[model samples]
Target: MTFEVFMQQLANGISIGSLYALLAIGYTMVYGILRLINFAHGDIFMMSAYFMVFGMVTFGLPWYVSAAIVIVAAVALGVLIEKAAYKSLRDAPRMSIMISAIGVSFLLENLATYLFTGVPKGFPDIDILTRAISFGNVSLSVATVVTPVVTIILLFVVLFITNKTKIGMAMRAVSKDFETARLMGININRVISTTFVIGSALAAVGAILWGSKYPSVIPLMGVMPGLKCFIAAVLGGIGNTTGAVLGGFILGMSEIMLVSFLPSLTGYRDAIAFIILIIVLIVKPTGLLGEKVTDKV
Candidate 1:
């Protein structure tokens, strides 16, 4: 590929990577605290898209207003799902929580299909972000140029919240010793809910940027992306936030560049993520940055 071509592909990779990173953080955060993979996270992201369509098209709201409302709605949905499905199962076996997560995923999928009739809705064109722009030889959409920047800013904000704030301290304490944190007066439920709130909000932002780039809204749209982001979380160390981001960028870059370099392999883009996941599991099951956990007998 020529320099310009490579630059374009790189830019595209970064945009895609940032979206994966946002979603992957959700997986990492939940796993860090609960030791459970939230299979419903991607569905939550999917719901955010429908939320956007309803707010923007049905309600006839402005783009900014609709975006804000959708983010809030997504957060509420996350908390509700956690409380309704996972809360009671907190003390249950790990398998029980995992099964509930899967169940929630399917429920959202079918619920969306039943409500929306499996039609692919057009994501309303938010002119400011969706408009195409020319950056020298490589032309791209405004969202393409803006996604990574926004993701980086948000990542820093999340990092600060988790590392420096009181809630962050509570989260860390809970992750280290859940029983002890509760004993020390940390509200376990509150910390978990806050984690969900942050995760869901990031998913909302990711969905908006993703919709702007892909512009398709369907009940099952989140399946592939969601799974890929999970792979990214695992690849980087499922419980580590920064590791998740690193894995996302690497996954996105590799997938994009692989296809760009060898067009014939375009069909294997999805497989690439799985292959990486398999290698990571075999080589370092705890993930690159994940600590080995020893469960009590």
Candidate 2:
């Protein structure tokens, strides 16, 4: 490929990777605190897209207003899911929580299909977002250039919250040792709920950018991206936020470069994350930046 083509693909990879990173952050934050994979997280992402569709197309709201509604709705849904599906089972066995997560995921998917009729909806176009920018030889979509910048800004915001704020301190305490954090007078439930809210909001942002990029919304739309983002989280060290971002960029770049170099493998692009997940699990289970934690007997 030519240099311009390579640059264009690189931009595409970063844009896509930024979305993965956003979703992976949610996964990592939830896992860090609850040790739950939250299989339904992707469904929440899907729901946010629908929420946007409803807000904009059904209600005739502007894109910004619809986006705000979607973010708020996603936060509420995340908290609700945690309270309804996860709270009661918090003391249950790990397997039980995992099953609940899976059930929740399936429920959301089926419910969406039933309500939306399984027909894909065309995402409304926003000229400002969908417009392409040309810089010399490299041409890129507005979202492509904007997504990574937004992801980085949000990453910093999250880091600040986790490291500089009181709630962040509480979160760190909870993640480090849940029982000890409770003993020290931390509201376990609040910390966990806050984590979900933040994660879900990020997912909402991701869904918006994703819709802008792909322009189609379906009930099952989130499944692949969710799984791939989960893989990104795993590759970065499941509980590590910075690692999650790094892994996302790596996965995105790798996938793009793979398709560019091996055009025949284009059809197998989705498989790339799975293969990476397997390789990471076999080679370094703790992930690139993940710390190895030993369970007490």
Candidate 3:
């Protein structure tokens, strides 16, 4: 490939990597707090994309306007889903809660398929995102630059919330010990809802950008990216936000490089993530930056 082609691919990888990072943060954050994989998270991302499409097609709104709506809707959905499905089983066995999450995920996906049908939908055109910026031999799409910028901003905001704010302190406390934190006067319900809100909001941003880049929307659009982001979360060490982003970038670059350098392996792209995941599980179960946990009886 030529220099320009290489630059474009790199740009593509970074853009997609940032989206993966955003989605991974949601997975890691929820797992950090509850040790539950919100299986519906992928569909939540898909719903957010659908919301953006609805905003444009139904209300004739601009992309940014729809984005704000998507963020709000995603947060609300996250909190509501937790209340309706997971709350009842919070005190149950971990396996039960995980199964409930899986059920919730399947429910949402089937509902989406029923409502939206099996056909794919195209993302509405937003001229601004299509524009390109060139610097020397390097060229970048507006969405490409926007993706990383948005991810950085949201990542910083998440970090600030988890580190500096009072709610952040509560989140950290709850993640460490829910009953203990509750005994100390922390509102577990509120904190959990807030955590879901933040995670879902990030998902909304990621879904919007992912849709814009791919310009395709389907009921199942989030499946692949969601799984990949999950890999990213685990790769960097689940519950570690910084690690999630690092892993996302690495995964993105590696996948792009694999396709670019070894054309024969393009068909195995999806399997690459799982292969890495299995390798990590076998060699380093705690992940690259994950902490090893020991239960005390």
Candidate 2: 10-residue stretch with minimal lDDT = 288-297
Residues 123-169 of candidate 3: C-alpha lDDT, one tens digit per residue: 77777886888879887778898998889888899999999999999
lDDT value, residue 55 of candidate 1: 89
lDDT score, residue 158, model 2?
A: 97
Query: Candidate 1 — which residues are off by over 4 angstroms?
Result: none
lDDT of each residue in 1-297, candidate 1, tens digit only: 898899999999999998999999999999999999999999999999999999889999999999999899999999999999999999999999999999999999999999997989999899999888887898888998999899889889989998999999999999888888899999999999999999999999999999999988999999999999999999999989988998888899989999999999999999999999999999999888888977754
Show pairs that collide, candidate 1: none
Candidates 1 and 3, the one with greater lDDT: 1
Q: What's the lDDT for residue 65 in model 3? A: 91
* Over 4 Å off, model 2: none
What tens digits encode model 2's per-residue C-alpha lDDT throughout 89-126?
A: 98788889999999999999999999998889999887
Q: After superposition, how far is residue 2 of candidate 1 from its true place, in Å?
A: 1.9
TM-score of candidate 2 relative to the true fold: 0.99
Candidate 1 weakest ten by summed lDDT: 288-297
Off by over 4 Å in 3: none
Give each model a TM-score.
Answer: 0.98, 0.99, 0.96
